[model samples]
Target chain A: MDSAILLVRVLDFVGTFVFALSGAALGVERRLDLFGVLVLAFVTAVVGGIVRDVLIGAIPPASVASWHNLALAVAAGLLVFWFARAVARLSQPVLVFDAVGLGVFAVAGTQKALDHGIDWPMAAVLGMLSGIGGGMVRDGLTAQVPTVLRSEIYAVAALAGGLVVVAGGALGLPPVPVALAGIGLCVFLRLMSLVRGWRLPVARPPEP
Target chain B: MDSAILLVRVLDFVGTFVFALSGAALGVERRLDLFGVLVLAFVTAVVGGIVRDVLIGAIPPASVASWHNLALAVAAGLLVFWFARAVARLSQPVLVFDAVGLGVFAVAGTQKALDHGIDWPMAAVLGMLSGIGGGMVRDGLTAQVPTVLRSEIYAVAALAGGLVVVAGGALGLPPVPVALAGIGLCVFLRLMSLVRGWRLPVARPPEP
Candidate 1:
């Protein structure tokens, strides 16, 4: 059943690029040094996949070992660094990129988990983690609570998408189409939250 | 050559307990809920070991698969929760615990990497990562710059300890004594740094 290796690879790179862009944008916006920006770009782009692979007993995670991913991340970082003023002006686009990245990462992560014979429930968990883990580490290096853990309607959407993919697989659906549907739903939910200003409720304002 | 399995196991538990205590203390000081405190304790206690395990191609990391570690973390959390005022009064102790945890984790991690047949340079790096990884994640969850990345002699101490272990191995020394020497050096350096107000240099404060 691990028939979706190519699909996972394609989606992984797509997610990497978009996530790198978002990470670079955030680092630039936060006024980090160029080195810091590049670090953010590289880490934000690949950490999710790395974490997923590590958990699934994949050694030397593909993203970590690939120079191509590094080149792409550096390219994204440089673009943001060189266009700081312009990038700064387009703050809203960062979230859009993040949404796209989340969708693809989730779908890819789920498919990879399935490829490795992970069951649906644990697979969905891994998939959702694959979607959000990078952004969490990105925010961490910036010294902030992860938006996913704070007020964003983020993790739920990722989990939902992962569940969709696994469910489709159970129904004997084609991998590519099922993956596409999962990505669509994840992106839709994330973007909708941004547009609608929807937020997960905080128990209370942190006790200051 | 892997003659120190017992040493590693002991060190791991020691590190886990102290790290969990420090994390629990931080969470209580930060006035987080019980759930948050426990999460912090659990994560801070085991994440370093988990990361080290994952990198070494070990499945379901010993720390992650161990209920004893969880019980210890929860116990630490509960202690802090029930005695918040007492814990809040002992801020300096938290740093001490963190330093101890770092030392033990570094030693344990170095030994494990060597046992896994990893080479020296990579083993040392992995060891340092193990020492610092948990504390970094703990600080991140609380929405702050990792103290290790900022003004601390943290990574250096861990790395140096790791080097000592590897050097001892290369010099044809026994594993257990070498590990203890490594741990001693790490703890000494960290403690001295605390006493002398030593810190890693920052180029300049981040521009506000």
Candidate 2:
């Protein structure tokens, strides 16, 4: 495999693991049983890509067709289940890992959309969708408002990364550099928002 | 259009209207602003079909591709927003409407899957998905556990309806009669569950 492809694959696995961990942690906090925790983790790790694949006409969804991704997600969930206390102490690290995953998925999704002959604008949209879709489903399953819909910077960062990929790809940039740039932009924006505690303004209550 | 196709379209619009009304009512209860109400209504009215269409590789999603569907959903939302107090008085009617919508979507989804040459088992699954997908998204956006996952018999009704469609199709039955039988089965099961308070067993909490 090409080095670029290899790097992407590695990042994908890393992202999936950390996302699953976060989901499992949430399940534990919610006092969900083992099955619910596993379900949440699997859905959180894979739903984004599945939604993207479906939107782009990838039949059966890659996550459903392949066992590798499902196994990794399930393994991560089981690990968290077993080491809940220890993993709880790594909250900061988990956040960082999640940011990395967000960046990687955003660029990867945009690239996939482009490969499928989608226009750049739609590719960018699909990238953001791919990046935020899992977290949305995770929060939904846990009965919480999705962070992307209400948070300060989640989807925006993903959108920024996707736009970068679209621009870079459109300009005939090298694949590795384009991917790296998008990832960097997304991670930087996410971390900055987290540290700054910035938030998107909520709509004021309508007058009765 | 064939008479069967026309009937399907009429039922589709009826389902969309009632589903949208329910979603809009929920938005009102949540005190969501006008935009949120419209969004909830639109999602509830169409998401199930969109999900089914995507799974079956029907590109562009029938819901997104049609202005008529969009208009009806929006109108339904607006009606609820403006007349919520009055609408609330008709709770009994709403339940009946919701059951009808559920039944029709279940059968329609299965038929569409078969038309796309999907196998019967998968078509049945997709049919259930189509019947329940919109409600899941609607509840999720409102920060609630999906009714299908936790409630009495929502998804069961859909699954039963889907199976009927699959069986009827496989037996070379006429489309109109098969579809009606599936719808009747779904509505009956759902209403019975509502009246009798049927519930799926919840998983036991894991040993701490």
Q: What are the TM-scores, per candidate, against the unseen true structure?
A: 0.61, 0.60
lDDT of each: 0.83, 0.78
Model 2, residue A59: C-alpha shift (Å): 5.5
DockQ of each two-chain model: 0.12, 0.12
Q: On residues A1-208, what C-alpha lDDT tens digit does candidate 2 reach at each position?
A: 7654565566567667777877777776666656556666777887788888887888866564445776787798888777777766664644665677788888888888887889989898998888888888887777677878666798889999989988986798887888889989999999888999866787789899
Best by lDDT: 1
Candidate 1 residue-wise lDDT, B78-163, digit = tens = 88777777666664757878998998899889888988999889999999999999999888787778978777688899998999
True contacts kept of each: 0.14, 0.17
The weakest ten consecutive residues by lDDT in model 2 chain A span: A3-12
Give Cα distance to truth, residue A3, candidate 1, Å. 4.5
Q: Write the per-residue lDDT of candidate 1 for residues A27-131, one digit (tens) a residue.
A: 987888999999999999999999888888787899777698999899988998998888778758578788999999998998888777776666776788899
